[model samples]
Target: MTEFVRVLLPLAPAVPLVLALLGLLLRRPTSLLPLAALPGLAAAFVSPTGEIISLPWLLLGISFRLDPLGAVFLGFASLLWTLAGLYAYAYLGGKQGEGRFCLFWNLTLAGTSGTFVAADAATFYLSFALLSLAAYGLVVHERSKAAWRAGRVYIVLAIFGETCLLLGLLLGANAADSLLIDDVRAALAVSPWRDAAILALLMGFGLKAGLVPLHVWLPLAHSAAPVPASAVLSGVIVKAGLIGLIRFLPIDALPSWADTLLWLGLATAWSGILLGLPQRQPKAVLAYSTMSQMGLMVAVLGAGFGAGVAGTTMATALYATHHGLAKGALFLAVGVVAAGAGRAAIPLLVVVAVLGAAIAGMPFTGGALAKLAIKDSLGSGPVGLLASLSAIGTMLLMLRTLVLLVAQRPPAAVAHASAGLIGPFVATAAAALVVPWLLFPVLTGRPLAYAFASPVIWDALWPIFVAVVIASPAFLRSIAVGDIAGPVEAVLRRVGGSWTAWHPPRPAIDGPRLLTRLVKPAQSLETWLAGSAASGSALLLVAVLLGFAALI
Candidate 1:
């Protein structure tokens, strides 16, 4: 029975991989697309307790596992993929790039699901790399200039992140003399270069998680991808980094750099909220919100590291699971709103409001539960207060997302969204609402009474109340902070510009004036060469010498 359960771990990733390859032969949109997620969803239930399965014949000794922590990630990843795949069926129907979309979609799905199950360093790296690389195709699927530009930025950052992870993994592996993740982590506890390894891992995973300063690619990439692709990319793929932080970082032991991590996480969280405020685009606002939410998760993980509590890891994973589902559903809702109009748009907008508000820690939602789970970890320190304040920011950001989404109705001439599109959208939103409630008991071992209790409910509601009070001014309500990101982004851009100005590359110089100068010299040389018999004789001599050398 155990072996059968473990078998599903590998099979989970295998399903989508096969589908991605088969997409090449697919003549058109087919019903078979969403089935790719079934295996993973099955594995989530079958291996909730997790079992380490070895594949000695595979790669020197590749291994896969399904611990409870990994199961949380796998469950949400599978659910989001299934819903997104369903949405794509209708979303991409009659679309010009359906084939390209399906191929990349399945590829990304395989990599994301596999990342959670990888038990060894090599397998994890391979899985992470696959996810990073394959997602680019989705980012650029529209083939527009903006899409291509976003893809370029995404690939560049992804490659840098991969390099950091590879080096970190190599360093840890060398210290431990083992390829297994468990062993490497054990070795890292006492390794001489442990801090360096941690720093590298943080940089690598933080980049993927859209941590501030490394998050430039996120908004551009999320907004550029197709709606379904954006949903999963923001919701599921980014969690790869969160899981990395969970697995690699020593949550059970307090490290010297724990404070630094906590600060970094807080910065990332607040930065997202501040930057997301000005955006008019619903998708972009949501993208920044993701960055903010990820920052909070990072902060929670850092808090766990500081406290060295056993439950912190589980809490972090549960929080991530909740955020992943809700965020994914909201992105999908962005599509529904775009397709809806007049009276048909009302219910969808209401659902969107509830879901968006949930991210703000609205009462009786997954976001509220997520906050409760992490409360103990955050503790009663200044960090805790800051974390609470961050919720207000989240509320403000969600308000912007709601307004943008509501204002995005299709033209009067457009048709109502087909059932195919609305079906997945509504299904995902329902899951976001109900699934978290069902899993709360399993994840926290806490009763529904605790979740709905007066104190916890009020704690969740206050932040939202504060946000509304602040935004009550009519002008302030419409204020968007997205266009010129807050102080952090402004500072980053200034610093980057200064660095570039200080060290401009000669070979890659641009501007028509410089080009004209360089081209004029080249043109003059060309004319001189054409006019001069001596130059021609010299060229002929060089060619003759080269020909002679070749003959010899």
Candidate 2:
């Protein structure tokens, strides 16, 4: 029974995916969206233990492990995907190409769920690749120029991240002489390539986590994607990278690298907030906020790394799980409001504010428990100071998001919002409040009361208060970066015009300009021969002959 449940746990996410694919073939995509998360829901509740399903031919195997860490991620990721799936139904009702969106959505769900259970390098890579690539369709679903451009940027960054990860995994496997995660960690602990492996892993995963300097694509992609897609992108897809960091890196073995990770994480946390403050779009603001939140997660991991491996993993996962649910709910709220669910706006806004504060470690929320869990790891240092300030940054960003939501609300929308939209939004908001408390005691090994102590509550509140103070003048002034579209469009036009002007037109072979333009047959033939298929075959044949002759 346990074995069966284990197998089903990983396959659960795939069921929705398979149904979605079937829907595509049958030209009945909408039916698949709601059913997409059924299997995952079952898996989360079953709490299956480790079960491996090998596929030697594919050079990979699936393993479902329901350890506390994986379970925390899988539980919420599945829940969020389920809710987002339902939301997508209403959000995208009557839209053309629902089939394409559903297809990518399911594939992403499969990849995300698989990542939590994958025990080997091959399985992890395959799942990571699926999540990364399938998300491209979502990013470009609108088929608009901006969507296409955002998709392009997303693909480039994603592929780059993949390359780094592939190389890192190869190094990991080579050092370990086995692809199993436990073995890899054991091997990495004693391996000579530890530093190189760490660097590769950090770059690969950091890109996806939206770490600074490599995070340029995040805001653009999130803002451009459809609402449901944005929710999953911010909520689930980014967590895959966090999982990768937690699972792959040898946090136990390297204190120096851990410290370095602490600094890098701090940099990412600040960078996201600083850039986010200048943005105007609600989705884009959320994207930067995701980046900022992930940075804090990375910091937690880094500090945990410094303290000890086991604590770091547990604490990081706890923090990530909290962020995932809260962020997912917030993104879903963004979509609901945008779709004209404004009647419930006040309560939803309050929900958003609390989640935002919770992110900043507000008392009684999961975020505060997460902060308490990691406080020991980070210690009372400058890293702690930055961590505190990050919460403040989150508060400011959320406040900005709330203001934008209020300003952008349509007058008519204030009175009517569909129950279909409101239901999931409310459920998610409620989960955002409740689930964290349920998970906190188990993950943190601390009493719930620890989260509400005077010092802890004060610590969380003051940063938000400071941020509120800083943002008041800016908010009152209606300060904004103004429309960036005009300058960007003009630059694109100029670049296109220049390319046209610089290119010489082809002349007819028999025309007056043909003689000057045409190449000599001997030269042209030589050039063509060097690049031609026949020439390439000949070169290959010659190389083979030379090798044979040498062997003789």
Candidate 3:
């Protein structure tokens, strides 16, 4: 029974993907959204605990394990995917090429869920590749010039990330002589190549997670994708890299590298805030916010790595679960507003505010719990201070998001949103609020009541206060940061103008001349060598040279 559940758990996400393909082929793509989420939902509830199954003959003996960490991420990711799926149903109704979107959507879902459950290097890589590539379809669904450009940037960065991960996985497999995560981790704990492996893994997964410098594609991709795609892309897909980092990096074995990661994570956290401030589009702003939040997650993982691997897995998983749900809710709320659901606007605003607070580590939200769970690991020094500042940065970003949300209201007020849309939005918001509280005690081994204490609550509130205070002047002064890409656009246009001027088009050629021109002197020489006499002469010359050399 346990083994069956383990195998079925991995297969569960694929069911919806298959159904989506069938629906597309049958020209009944409307049903594909709900169909895509069912397997993920079932797996979340029915998969047995601590089950491990191996298939050595397939994909280098890939393994699947339903451990606590995997279960937490899988459960939340599945749940969010379901909500996004339902939201997509109504949001994309009667839209053209939605069938294609649904197909890619389901494929990405399957890959993300599979990544969480996969126990071996090969399985993880397979899932990672699938998720990354399928997401490209989502990014470029609009097929506009901007979307195309965004897609190009996304693919290039994604390929770079994959190469890094593949090399790391190879090193890991070679060191351990096993592809399973547990064995590789165990091997890394004592191996001399630990630093190299961790660095490779960080670069690969960090790119996906939108760590600094590698984060260039995230804002562009998220802003260009359709609403539902953006929701899942920002909320869920990026977390795959976080899961990879948690699973593969030998956190317990390398404190020095871990500290380095923590510092880098700090830089990432601030970089997003610094870069995000200048954006006008709400989606682009949110994209940068996602980058910032991902940086915080990286910081948490770095802290865990520094502290040793004992509790890091569970801590990172809990943090990721909270982030996945809250971020999904926030993105969905953005979609609701964008759709002109004005009557539902204020309430959604409130919900978004709460979600934003959670991202900023407001007391009693999932974010606070996540922070507390990993607080000890981060320790009290510059690292902790930097971690605390991330909360402030989040607060600033969220405040900016709120101001933009209110300012960008449609010229005409809209009626309430459909149940299909509002239902998932509300469900995710409630989960973001309540689920973390329930999970916190189990994850932190502390009383839930500790969260409400004055000191803890104050710690959470003051950072938000500071952020608000800092942002108020900027808001009042009408100091707009503007778009970062604007300057680049001017430069590109200038270069394009110069190139067009420097190169003039040639006149059309007649057929014979065109064919002759196509075959250059080098090509004619190659063709002549390929003829029978030339081939025989060339071979004879080579044979004679060999004979002369032998005789000498």
**How displaced is residue 506 in candidate 2, in Å?**
8.9
Error of 3 at 153 (Å): 0.5
Q: Tens-digit lDDT track for model 3 on 1-552?
A: 765656577575567667756867756575667656666566766887666766777655666777777778877887888888888888887788878888888889878878988878888899899999999999999998568767866786687778778888888888899888888877876777877877788888998998866676788899898887898898889999888887888765677777777877778788788777766777777888888878877887778677664576677677777877888888888778877765677888988898888888888688888777777767778888888877887888788788888887775456556787888899988988788888887877889888888988988889988987888524332212222232332333344457758985465567667756754642543443232222234234433322332233
lDDT of 1 at 86: 88
Worst 10 residues of 2 by lDDT: 477-486
TM-score of 2: 0.85
> Best to worst by lDDT, what's the order?
1, 3, 2
2 or 3: which has the higher lDDT? 3
* Quality of model 1 by C-alpha lDDT: 0.79
Model 1, runs deviating above 4 Å: 1-4, 472-552
- For each candidate in turn, the TM-score is 0.86, 0.85, 0.85
- Among the numbered candidates, top lDDT falls to 1
Q: Candidate 1 residues 82-145, lDDT tens each?
A: 9888888888866787877887888888888878989989989988999999999999998885
Which pairs clash (backbone N, Cα, C closer than 3 Å) in model 1? 50-66, 277-481, 278-480, 278-481, 278-482, 279-482
After TM-score superposition, what is the CA distance of residue 126 in candidate 1 from its true location, in Å? 0.4
Model 2 per-residue lDDT tens digits across residues 189-217: 67888888778888889878987656666
